[model samples]
Target chain A: MDHLVILPILLPMFAGALLLLSGRASEGFKRSLCLLATLLQLPLAIALMAQASGGLQVYAAGNWMPPFGIVLVVDHLAALLLLVTAVLAIAAVVYAVRGDDLLGANFHALFQFQLMGINGAFLTGDLFNLFVFFEILLIASYALLLHGTGSARIRSGLHYVLLNLFGSALFLIAIGTLYGVTGTLNLADLSQRVAQLPAPDAPLVGAAAMLLLVVFGLKAAVFPLYFWLPKAYAAATPPVAALFAIMTKVGIYSILRIYTQVFGDTAGPLADLANGWLWPAALLTLVLGTIGALAASTLNGLISYLLVVSVGTLLAGLALDSHDALVGSLYYLIHSTWVCGALFLFAGIISRCRGPRFVGRLVPGPALSRPTLLSGLFFLAAISVIGLPPLSGFVGKLLLLRAAETGVAAGWLYSLLLGSGLVSIIAFSRAGSTLFWRTDPAAAAGGPVDNVRLAAVLALLLCSPLLVVFAGPLLDYLTITVDQLLDPQEYARQVLSMQISTSGGGH
Target chain B: MELLYALTLGVLTMSGVYLLLRARTFPVVVGLTLISYAVNLFLFAMGRLHTGKPAVLGQVAEHADPLPQALVLTAIVIGFAMTAFALVLALRAQGELENDHVDGRGKR
Candidate 1:
């Protein structure tokens, strides 16, 4: 009932619409408006986290009842993600403004719209409404991806677009089937009702689940379905790619939400079917994504492949189904989003200096040597991403290992995860060695580093230690989040109770 | 009557899969559209179609399942939007790359 729950979505949407309407306004105004809107959202997101930490809150739109109306539900897990997403978004917008000199007035507008779509997707509880928000985000991404529309970008962006379109189509079909069988789109109500279906309806439900898996799998860049990710990511401008980093995680969040909350009990034949095949699929995804990362040479390509690896790790975590595994996966998810996003931004900075052809090679020499301070910061960030000790990345990996050990599938998955981590370390080291350590004679001729770009890099670099220090509380928060996820009846009751209270009062 | 719906599902699945497997982006787009149509129809079918009865409840008759129908309407709109975006992106790619390969990344 409170405004806090919906503002995270509404603020960006209103900002985006305003930016579009004021498209002819000065760039300063647009930038300030975007910054003000994003800055305003941070406090709102914090307030939501505080409210949700106590219990789940569901807001049914337009005063409509469930199983019929669209709902916006925020549990601890969703709230935590919303908070993380908001923080990353703020950093990204700042970086975009500082680093991307080529960005025009329309850039801010598209960026706002993209944020609106992302927040909307996370907040919505209705399946169809989820699709609506997804489209809003995807359309905005299409424009952002093709901002400059070079041949390479257009080629890669198209691949990203077509593949996602296929996924969206499948998503539609899945929603259709689920609706036909369950006769309801409300997630909270569906969670309770789907389990009560007759035996004959099992296949239909299974089909729907499988279709959904495919749709989300593509979005998450899962194995055999991740062919479009690496190049598309590599070709985009850094800020755009940084935003893209959040996109796949959003897909993962959806999968986790739907699989556990809406379809919690996989009993009887369908349960057996999901368990038998899904885990193996996860295994393949983990292995393939790791191999791809190891093989890639370019910085952008390397980070792109790592994204695939991270997706694999997440899938493996879900497949194992241990609380430890879930915690590890969640931890890894946060670490990867920040690390990968930072790296992409760094890659952009490097590319700006050495040109796009600078992959797997350093500048000819130390051209911008005045700010020894900036290089020091970049070094810390780079080491952190490579999972060196006393940083967030290392702690996340440690949790994953610990989680893997607690499960029966750990014997094999643990080894795979370990191997993947090693490969990732090596891949990152190789890229770092080429980009940061290598001293090319030609690079020395370039002028001093831009202060704005240096500041953005430093900001990200400073986050490394904070992650390590705060790991205890972060882990506790995730544990509570997982507990809420596992037992969603609490969520359902909260929503239903709220509805009864409001209806009684209104009448 | 339900058998007819099942047969249509088979046809839709076949065509959609066939189109999806094509190398060209346009065909894939077409295939996706067909699949979406089939999916919407199948979801509608799940409510168990009744002869001479609409979903609206009246004074004298039992209402068919309103939930699936309402859900289908939403799906249709989303499906159309997805298709439109995909088509525009595809056309843009074709213009930019001078090729129509659905997998636009150069050499995998």
Candidate 2:
């Protein structure tokens, strides 16, 4: 009955609709409204996260019962992700306001709509509703990706759109198969039904589950399915790309939700299905992503590849399917999303300070405006990203590697993670030296970037060290979250237990 | 009825895949549209393909599963929106780049 479960979604949805309708408003008006809305979201998200830590909170839409009406479930994992998303949402909005808003019309509205989709996707407890939210976010992203009109944006955006459309088709097919076999779309109901599935229907359900994996994998940008990511992401405008850093996490989130909650070891033959292939594929993704990062000539390309690396690392941990591994991945998930968001925005500012033509290339350039701040920020981000000690990235990597010490593919996990770290160190060092140390003294500085942009970038960058500072409490929280996640029957009981009371014996 | 539905679904999906693998945006769009149609039909069939049965409650001892119908309806609308957006993107790319190839290469 806690209404907070749906407020995050509703607040953004209404704000977006209002922004669209008030077409005559000044950009400043729209931007301020958006800023206020996103700022308000932080407190709400924190409260939700706090409440969910105690127990699961379910909100049935329109007071209808679960398994019949749509429900939004806020468990610990969803709550944690909602908080991470809100943080990035704030950063992206601030950046858009400072500069990127000029690129297109109704930027604030589309931004809010994007948040609504993301928040909805994170909070919804129904599979069909998840699909709806995916489309919502995708449509908004398609517009945002093309926010700044350019040949490169349009070209990459087309491929991005088409690839996702194909993925959506696959998603629908999966949902239909699941529904046919299980007769339910509510995630809790689906979990129960999957547990008791008839033997004859096992293959059908397995096929559906595999199909769902492919769809989520495409979104998460796992190994073969990730071809659409680098170009598409690199082509997006900075704020949009920053928001997209979390989009891949949504795929990871769904994989965690569906696999652990619905198809865990209790689902007969379907038990541990993803395990056979997930770890190998995740290692491949890590290798490929690191290689891409090392070979990338442009900083944007490098960061895009690094995003893939983070996904790989997180999925590798998830594939391990142990409490320690899931806990480590969860920590890494929070740390990586923030760092990636900060880095993307920082890369944008770096590019802006360099000439447009020289944006993000490793070649030497004139000293940028705000040389000290930009270089310092870049150094900190580089350290954090490369997993140097005394920063958040190191903590995440340490936990993951430590967790892997007790897993089956300990060698592969440790080697790939360490190797990826080394490659990133070299790649970042080279790019840093090229940008900061190798600068030409007499070459003219690019135009002065606004102070607001620097603040926006710093806001996200500062969170990395803050994570290191608060690692004690955060790790404790993640331990409980993972404990909750590993026990699916408890989750099912909490979700469905409400059904009996809420239904009031109506049936 | 089941065999007929299965055959139609197979044909649609096969052709959809054929167009999807093409080098041009137009064919890809058509392929996407066809695939979505197949998926919609497939979802509708998940309700078990009852003929002449009302989806309304209490209409008979047996009724069609209303949930998949609702799901299909929603999917169709979303699919339409996706197609429109994609076509516009393709048109814009074609006009801007002077190419309709999916890759947007000028000479390819």
Weakest ten-residue segment in model 2 chain A by summed lDDT = A498-507
Q: Give a tens-digit lDDT track for model 2, residues B1-108.
A: 899999999999999999999868899999999999999999999999888899999879888889999999999999999999999999999998889898889465
Q: Which stretches of candidate 2 lie above 4 Å from their native place? A: A406-408, A440-443, A499-507, B106-108
Worst 10 residues of 1 chain A by lDDT: A359-368
Highest lDDT against the true fold, candidate: 2
lDDT of 2 by residue, A85-176 (tens): 99998998999898688888888899999999999999999999999999999999999999998898888899899999999999999999
Every candidate's CA RMSD: 3.0, 1.6
* Top DockQ prediction, candidate number: 2
- Residue B50's lDDT within candidate 1 is 88
- Tens-digit per-residue lDDT, B11-93, candidate 1: 98799889978867788889888888887887677687887777877744777887778767877787787788778878877
Q: What tier of docking accuracy does candidate 2 attain?
A: high
lDDT of 1 by residue, A106-130 (tens): 7777888888888888888888788
